[model samples]
Target: MTLQAGTDTALAATDHGAASSNDYRTGTAARLAGLPVETLRVWERRYNISETARSARGQRLYSDAQVRRLSLIKQLVDEGHAVGSLARLEDEQLRTLLPAATPAAPAPARPVKVALIGDALVRRLAGGGRELFALDIVGACASLEAAGRLRTSGAEVLLIELAELSDAALAPIAALRAQLGAAAVVLYRFGASATLARLRADGCIVAHGPADLSQLVLLCESARPGAPQFADAASIALAPPRFDDASLAALASMPSDLICECPRHLAELLMMLNSFERYSGECANRTPADAVVHRDLGVAAGQARMLLEAALERLARAEGLALPVADGAA
Candidate 1:
């Protein structure tokens, strides 16, 4: 059997007979369901779920009938069903039961494992309602790629947390988009900005409010079976970035008197300055390299340099002298 990205590909393949008739040896069932081997044992021993015949060596071998039952059990569990309750369910009962729990409210779509990247906002919004595989940005992307290759839980949409996105995080996001194409790419930003606009231009659907986001996801899921679509929900006005007092205090306390202005220190400072300068030039040129910093740093032209200067001024005032980088030498 061959594997490929997207569930449709697998469903379209000619190996359905082979997959359905495969023997349910211990490892085979677990491999297909992507569940733990120990889970299989627990369901059988503790829950009386899977009844298997043992060989002379005492190894359990399940029938194809058992494998199909176990596969549904895994899907249900992954969708957040209580394992104990599901283990008691027969195959017919489980199928009737899954549709209600799988969808957010109405019709149950096919089981598509989505990898949520960034903050816990997506979890809170969905309220653990769907079969979501939550992973950090890095892990989520890796899982998406793997699922695409395996044709099991291929990512149909990405729920990205812009507030949590760092300068380093953009590369993986870009890679995912390049790999997945103009699929449903949902980005949640702190507020509306040129940065969000840029992301939208690069084929992202931007949502600034949580309410709007929840609705947008519903729409995207609805559109999945019908047509490829895009939305300019970026028109939704949003508030500016706000920091709490504790966060402000923490930012204030970061630069210390230990920041040496020696030649070595100055050299490092100059390198950083030069790097930022080069980054700015590349950004102006609209090269792919510019996106490296654009997504990771979220730095804007004109204002960013001035902001850096202002920060150094505050640091110098706190330290009671000119900082090495602030001086012309750096």
Candidate 2:
């Protein structure tokens, strides 16, 4: 779920907790179904996935049935179903598309082959003087270029560390993954929330980089499929704001040639995100666990802000409106 959706629904969570036990607003439905709100909107716009109902107040709402249906579709899409194909399935037919659940057989024991990146993480592991669990370090190197020289192609895991992460880091990292042929990756980052969301969305396992050796190893272990990725469990948290209050206000008030409320609405959404981001930071001060949770929330919020900001920018450009002063992530 996007930070917006997560915060919106999380604030309004009900007691009933199952796949299909509650009516939900759009954001809540998206959160429960594990789909981004934009993706949900796209599916509805392009495929008519559900004939959603409206509340008495004229707000769109999703039934428990619709939420469950979307969840099933999301799982299928993650497993490689084309969205268009799944959109055409009837509710009953869609249920049938899900694989039958059976008892999970114990996985065969084998040492995981892992390639390491980053000198600090490597030294941290080595400096700890610990024997890792079922892990075989195939190649340990300081940079992706050096790893290429190590010839650890087809390694099962890629464990990397970065002092700071940005959206730009993904491309090079992806290239390294292709070269190394790593099936799973664990990233330790003291990085931007916006970057973390994009990374998580692309299916990378991310963790706070300051963890001790044992914790880092466990994070790598969680990267393997079905091992309960903690980063995934963390989910993307509340996001930080990209634009400040004044900037959003100016953008919201700008005179425009376009005949729509979208620009203003986008600004309003961003203001809400900004408020929540600040709220999350304040929440972080209470305890260590809160710090982690709020940090994730801030990351989710930052990512969400970036998405809305792009939309606002496109509209501003299309309308030839004067833009507000730009700002960086908070």
Candidate 3:
């Protein structure tokens, strides 16, 4: 993400012979604009959202103004505006259409108590604690050992900074969540599609960057003790759909003997169902325009998983194979 900010005309002058502010390559522009490179290209070709210039070798470059315009478009799109309607507007006109930026709301009377779990996160909070005044920092820890102490530190939220999206990184977070019981767990990490999906599946509210303070605050504010865990609708929309009847039928049709031999397979299916239920609940909390598609998909997955689990359990019993007692069973 280039930090340079100026109109295209000014940038053009700089390109010619003046002091040069860094111009962004297409990839960098995409990051700054919060759009995929392909989406950016489509907007340009279909909507002419921004005009691009080519370098000597034909690499596309975006001026800061163009990146800003793309960012505005993305913000509006997320807010439920149609791209076709917004595409033709000039930058200044689009700005007028956007809701005015408001100051962050004052911290709630009883702010969510947060526990910090990374050196970088600790430093970041220390530097800009004001932006997160809505959260009360009850404890700070750099390692799992220190994080363990948070259980008794009166912290109601665990905010962990993760370096990657791998299972290894997630394992400790899972442990923390389990240990803390009702405490809400939030993860901060920069990840690709796969990682983000996994994080969401695990019921973690994820922020892609440290600078996403507002998003982080919203997640914290939404956290409630003993509340059902759920995936964000945006995250669910990005996940591959899992409720196809054919797929569920194939899974159910597996030989009873084979399924019984690996009883953990049934257990894993139950876990998947539990995860999807949380996602379904989360989808329900979102606005209809944002949540409808994902909410319907989540409900479908939950229904399919539930039926499949029942069918498998019947098959196990019919095969005279005793399944392990399920959690919450008397």
Candidate 4:
């Protein structure tokens, strides 16, 4: 009768009681509910949706019923129900409002040959293999070194779970793709916005967390040979600011009072442009098509840096100041 934060509301009747200590953890619950851990905490804090148990160390332990309730809430929210209104509804009442759960799509004719790089994801998928009949996990490796020694596994797809994106991490993945002739490489990570463009440029399919297993499975199904690559126009459109002739002239003719500030500002702008230049080069080298876009971006950044340096030199001359040494120049 009483609904508590982190406790199962609707599925409590089926389970006949509260969640046991050995049930789902906060991370597992977040994955199952298709919600981030931070979002889960906020829901508990604000709505008291489910009551969770605590471990000796005070870690939140979610029961199976609680996870199910959270999943239902996510589904309802996706269907346009506000969490504030649904927070007070009982399981039966919420179920009445929800459309009947649809059956999963039938498995593909040929099971996808998948190689997993993350241990946690491998365990989750291996444990629930029956639920994902469309995927045939051929290999699971903790690192690229292990993947290199794997013999007799013809995995067509690579599923990489990374904590963050970096050139170092991607180098090995590129080698793996070339070695295995992989048809697709999917990346799963949280807070991927910062590196999403670079990852896409490297021909990766990115899934930002906390994504559900079903969603991950769907990504595998969708990643196929000759499939259209991922593109985010807004992210790609982000480039260094370009100044017109008039703006350059205005900066060149700035008042003597403000001319002193020009060099420092130009130095900062040059640093940013150089950073983007490196990023574009990395992306361009990833694949052939990537060369087109990233090359253009790199060229633009390089030209901007040069022009800014020239402007800085002019400003210095106007103010009778010495020119700062340009970055990477003798």
lDDT of each: 0.46, 0.64, 0.58, 0.61
Backbone clash total for model 3 is 0
Total clashing pairs for each candidate: 3, 11, 0, 7
lDDT of 1 at 142: 22
Candidate 4: count of backbone clashes, pairs at least 3 residues apart or interchain:
7
Q: Which tens-of-lDDT digit does each residue in 145-260 have in candidate 4?
A: 45665432566778777666665666677787888888555555544454665666666677774456677767776775644544533344433434433344454445455525
TM-score of each: 0.29, 0.36, 0.36, 0.36
Which pairs of residues collide in candidate 4? 5-50, 5-51, 6-50, 6-51, 6-52, 7-50, 7-51
- Error in Å for residue 119 of model 4: 1.0
Ranking by lDDT: 2, 4, 3, 1
Q: If ranked by TM-score, best first, what sequence of candidates would result?
A: 4, 2, 3, 1
lDDT of 2 at 76: 82
Model 2: runs farther than 4 Å from truth?
1-108, 128-131, 183-189, 226-330
lDDT by residue (tens digit), candidate 3, 4-48: 111111112112111113345555566557777789778878877
**Model 3 whole-model lDDT (C-alpha atoms):** 0.58
